[model samples]
Structures are given as C-alpha cells and as structure tokens.
Target: MGTDWVEEGSPSSSSVVKTKRLMEGLLLQGKNSAIQLQLLLKNSQDGSDGSGSSSEELLGKILGSFAQGLSLLGSCSESASAGHDRRVSPSSGESGESKRRLNLKDRRGPHKRSKASQTWVKVSSTGEDNHAWRKYGQKMILNSKYPRSYFRCTHKYDQGCKAAKQVQRMEDDPQMFQVTYIGVHTCWDIMKTPRMLIADPDTCVDECFPIKQELREDAKSDLTNDNVPSADFFLITGLGSSDQPNGPASVSSERMGFDDANGDHAVPTMYPFGDVANSHGLEIDSLSFDGDFSFDESEFLASDEVIELRN
Candidate 1:
C-alpha cells in the first residue's frame, strides 16, 4: 500500500487540472461570442432605433449565458475529483466498529490556484479514528486514577518510522486525545521554539530556566545523606538477596522509596536522560534571576528567595 495512494496530483491536483481545462474551453467560447457581438453592433448603427434596442437585449443575453456556463463548469470540475473529506461522527451503537459514510461535495479553486497558507494539522485519538497504535508501556501514576498508555508506531521497525503517541483518557470525557505525530523525533527543532513546538500547555519555566548545576548539586547533596539510606532499604525489600541481580536494582531502590503512605515518592524528580537538560545548559539561572523573565510562576517552582541589597 506504500505507493498505491500517492499519485503525483492526487484528487486535489486532478480537480485543479479539470478547472484549468474548463477555463480554457470557456475562454475560447467567449472570444468567438465577442467577435459576433462586434460584427452585429457595426451593422446595427445604420438601422432604426428599434434595431439598436433589440441589439442591446441580444448582447445582454449572450453575456448572461456565458456567465451561467462558467458557473456550471466550476460545479462539474469539482464533481470530477477522486475522493471526499471523510469525517467520522460518534457511533450511536456500542459495537464501536460501525461507521457512516458521508459524501462531501468537492470544492474547486478560482482561476488562480494557490496552496493553502495555513497548514491542516491532526492529533491522534485511539477511539476516534481507524488508525492502529501499538502499546509501548503503561505507567501507574501516583495521583491520577488512570495509568498513562505510551504508544509507538506499530510499523516502526518495518517502515523505519519513529512516530509515537501518548494516550491519557480524559477524566471527564470518554474520548481520548490521541496525538498522531507525523514526523520522527526532532528534539532540537522543538527546543528551538519551546513555546510553539512543545504541546505542553504548562509553563515555559522548565525550558526558560535550564536546571543550574549549583541547584542540581544542592539537590544531590541534600539527597546524599537521606536518599542513600532510603534507597538501600528499597534494594533489600525488592531484590530479596541476589548476587547476579534480576534487573537494574537502582530503579527499584530509588523509585519505590519516593512514595509516601499512598505509595507515591516525595523527591523532586529530574529527567533520567540529560538530552533535554544539556540543551538548556544553565540558561534557567539567568532567566530566573532576571525579574523580567520570571513572572506568575505556579506550583512547579513556588518558592523563590531573593536577597535584597541596600544601595
């Protein structure tokens, strides 16, 4: 199915081609009609007043007919296209597989065919569309009731495509917002325009303020005395005495102890990989120190201590 659907000028291209043909046909007809009108007007000037009145009506009718022909041609060119924009409505039945087909009338462009200025983008939905997704993992979050489902392209290895999606069903609605990523991972591109590229509606503080090495060192130092002990306790409980070790004991040791009575950890979390962290590279301190960059910060970084100096 790779090349089956990719025609040079798909339906849109064909519709445009048809429109051009119709305009050419109409242009030739209009030229011939204009020549006939010119000849009639020259002869009518020599005739009586009644002859001039009849000639005006005849010319008007010819122009009116030409206008009607152009309109009909536009509709016909649209109809001659290949496919329709199919929209899937919520199913009435429980089966979920049921779909109703809609025939949307095609629209033709004016004589000037131009590409759409704005791009049409789509977010994926597990329950909404007919596309298939493969499950990568299920994460049991501490506060949230439902676990987040991570998905990667099912055709990834076969097609060498790196599209991925994260599906978290809304607590209020049954509909899941499946973000269908079109392209592969381009983290640099995303980091360039943090606000525009990143879909997170959350604050830009994370990107604006890259984690300072001093703060990170402080966090590590703060945890060095306390975390090591708790992590050691976690290792003893999870591993149950294994020399070889079944898996990476560090995960079970560090993560499990972060939980409280509700089994949720209380430690300030840092990213596992330094990919994003390094990209920002101490930019956060400058942004944070500067009063202009930091404004209306929420729960993420609630506490900020500013030392005042008397001038």
Candidate 2:
C-alpha cells in the first residue's frame, strides 16, 4: 500500500542535486569564514588576553556562535547524504520492484503530478509572505554576507501544511533579503469567512498572523451572549501571555471554565495588525515603524468574530 508520489524535486532530480551541492559548498565557505573570524579575534587579543571588556566579550560571543554553526553544518551535510542514499538505494536492486510499481501507480489516478507554483521575491530582511511561517533552521551560506534562514508553514505540524521557503540576504543589498518559496499552500486561504475555510483541528488565524504561542491558560473570560464563539472564529498569539506580564487568556462558557456548559472550548481569536503588532514581524511596511504594512488586510477586517483583540 505504498505511494509513488515523489516530491517536486527530490534527490532523484539532477537540479536538486546541483542545488544540494551548492548548499554544501556554501556551508563549507561559512565554516571557513567562521574560522577566519576566530583567527582575527585571536590576533586582536594578542596584546591583551582576557580583557573581559565589552568588545572582547562581543567577539567571543560571535566566535562561539560561529563554531556552533560549523558543527551543525557538518551534521546537515551528513543528513543530506543519508537521505539521498535512502531515496536512491532501493532502485539499485530487486528490493525496488514494489517501489517501482507504487511510484508508477502513484503517478496515475489521484496522485498525478501537481502544478504547485514556486515564486521568489526580493525584499529587505525580516520579509514575510502573506502566510505565517515558523522559523525552523538557519544555515551559513557561501559568499553571502548573511546566513540563510529556513522557514516552513506554521501549520506544518498543526494542519499538515507543507509549504516552505528559504530566505537569504542579498550581498549587494545587505538590508534586503531574497526569499525562495517552494510549494503552494494547501491549507485555507486566510479563511475570511467560515464558509470559505474548512475548519480543522488547527486553530485558525488570519493569513497574516498565526496562533503560535499560548498567551493565556488560566485567565477565563465570561462568555456573555455577545462574546460567545460560534462557527467562525480565529485565535491570536505573540501578544504577552495572560498569566505573565500579559498573562494567559482563557475561555469559559460560564464565568470561569475551559469549556461551555456543553463542554466546548472557546474559539480562537485573531490579532489585528498595525494597531497591536507589526504585521507579525513580517516587516512588510515601507514606511517603517509608526506605519502599517499593506496587503489584503481587508479580508481579516471583514470578519467581525475574528477581530476581538482584547477580552
């Protein structure tokens, strides 16, 4: 009962292999850069060892982080190699017989090749797409002044979203970043209306912000007739927790409880950008702070139930 659905550009693709090799080369380059930085730091400290001053301390911190990055790069290289072997090994012998059949079968029927469009955008650092992405990995790249940051859909684990992208700072424009997106978002498209969004186990948020952190846990708000969550609802994260300085926010169907009289938990709430947060750190604003990032914000604004920022 195996499926032959190969990823858009698995190790089997020569292009992907070339890209991997390029990435590895970049990792090595980064390691070398780190080593050079350490040497420079050592030379600077030749006259005065253990100054313990702010400059020396800063250099030490930078060098230590670089060393850690080099080690992680070594592990990443090995993992990539191991994954490649796993993907190509079976095709080498009789063990691949069933796999071949499955791949062929997967290519047919519902498993047909997908037309997921891949797009790239050039922008400044901290750039963000319309959707929420969770920072997963950061790697040193070859010849680039800035390290590459890897991000995947925030819903990857929660809603089975597989969209991912890589961001690299441009050498010419250090303040700018290059974002390469891979995979179309199979999840809901912002879900302005409950009818437009298929409710799932995932706590829905606007395309702009995702419900990443639990802001409140014990602080319960009485669900009066007006405050009750019904079919369409969204959740907000990143604001200070209700329990801490911000504390944790909780939902109570009655006056102070987790669920309603029927045992239903509270529906999630959405965060409005500009007024509360800075586009969820997307840095989409052109005017910088004291301004707002413009996108299809109207979608989220249209939803009345999703905009209850403060309880």
Query: 237-283, model 1: which lDDT tens digit per residue?
Result: 11111221232211221111232332221232321112211121312
Mark the 10 consecutive residues where model 2 has the least summed lDDT. Answer: 248-257
Query: Using lDDT as the measure, which candidate wins?
Result: 2
Per-model RMSD to reference: 28.8, 23.2
Most TM-score-accurate candidate: 2
Q: Against the unseen true structure, what C-alpha lDDT does each candidate score?
A: 0.31, 0.37
Which pairs clash in model 1? Answer: 124-178, 124-179, 124-180, 209-284, 210-284, 258-265, 259-264, 259-265
| Candidate 1 global TM-score | 0.21
